[model samples]
Target: MRYSKEHKNQTHARIVKRASVKLRERGAHGIGVADLMKEAGLTHGGFYAHFDSRDALVIEAVTHAMDRSTERWRKLSEETPPEKRLSKIVNSYLAPEHRDNPGQGCAVPALAAEIARESSKTRRVFSGRMEQMIDMLADQYPGLPRKAARKQAMAALATMMGSLVMARVTGNSELSDEILKSGRDAVLERAASSEKKPPRRAATSV
Candidate 1:
């Protein structure tokens, strides 16, 4: 049966959306084209109609997931006070709900390990998205120089990702909660401390 352009576009989007969540739930290699197509309520032969290759689908899926995550973070930043933005993001990222539901949370914590083993093109795309995430966090940082703020964002993101990874790996829920709390406190403390410091004076040649 011949499908209209709109129908094809919608179906393509649906496949990518499902692929995004499933990619998070299953590692990069955990899912195959047939299963993804079945989950999308489409035929496996139709996969190539939407994407040139599985790698293409992977890139698109990761991009979709990261974009969804950033959009949520943008909303949080909008609704939150400038001083509280970082904390809100960190709390959301490290929450038990996010930890337990890998398919719905940020892609970084869910797919970072698997992405490292993907193709160079995939890694480059992920790297670019990671920068976007870092820059989003940096935007909320007031008073600090842009460079310093970006560096701070990088560190905070690393901590959040690592803490969540450890939390998920361990059998202890109590320890996991503690890890989240500690990660939050540490990031917030650093942010608060940075806010208190005076920006360095520019050097003047004598």
Candidate 2:
């Protein structure tokens, strides 16, 4: 029996959403197309109906995961006072809850390595989404010029992503926690220092 347009759309969404979480939890190549379709409660035969290929599904899944993370950061930044927005984002991202939940957390640390090895089209899509994230982060620093703020955002995001990767891989729980805390503290400190005004030079005699 043929499904209606709405039903088809819904099913497609379900597959993408499930694929997003599974991809993060198990890396890009860890799960096969049949397995993903099975988990989504659909048959492998229907996979082609929604996407042209497994690569297409992967691109869609990566986009979905990154978009969700960006939206989360946007909401956190919106709800916070401008002065505290950066700290709020940094804390929430580096928290233990985010660290322990790979399936629902940021996609960078989870999928960056895999994406680097993907096709050029896939890498381009990932790069575009990453740019959106960096731009959103730069918005939190209204005190700095656009270029300066973007530079700072790049540095801050790199630290957070790198720290998260290390935290997840380290066998020791205490070290993991310490890594999170250090990353959070360092980002906040760097942000604070960047916004400070430089001291005035003493007037020289003529």
lDDT of 1 at 11: 94
Instruction: TM-score for candidate 2, please give it.
Output: 0.95
Cα lDDT of model 2 by residue, 1-206, tens digit: 99999999999999999999999999999768988889888899989999999899999999999999999999998899988999999999998888889999998999999999999999999999999999999998898889988999999999999999999998349999999999999999998898896644799999
> Candidate 1 — which pairs collide?
none
Clash total of candidate 2 = 0
lDDT of 1 by residue, 95-201 (tens): 88888888988888888988999999999999999999999988878778899999989988898889888888873589888988888888888888989988778
Task: Work out candidate 1's RMSD over C-alphas.
Answer: 1.4
TM-score of each: 0.95, 0.95
Question: Clash number for model 1?
Answer: 0
Question: Where is model 1 more than 4 Å wrong at Cα?
Answer: 202-206
Clashes of each: 0, 0
Q: What overall lDDT goes with each candidate model?
A: 0.89, 0.92
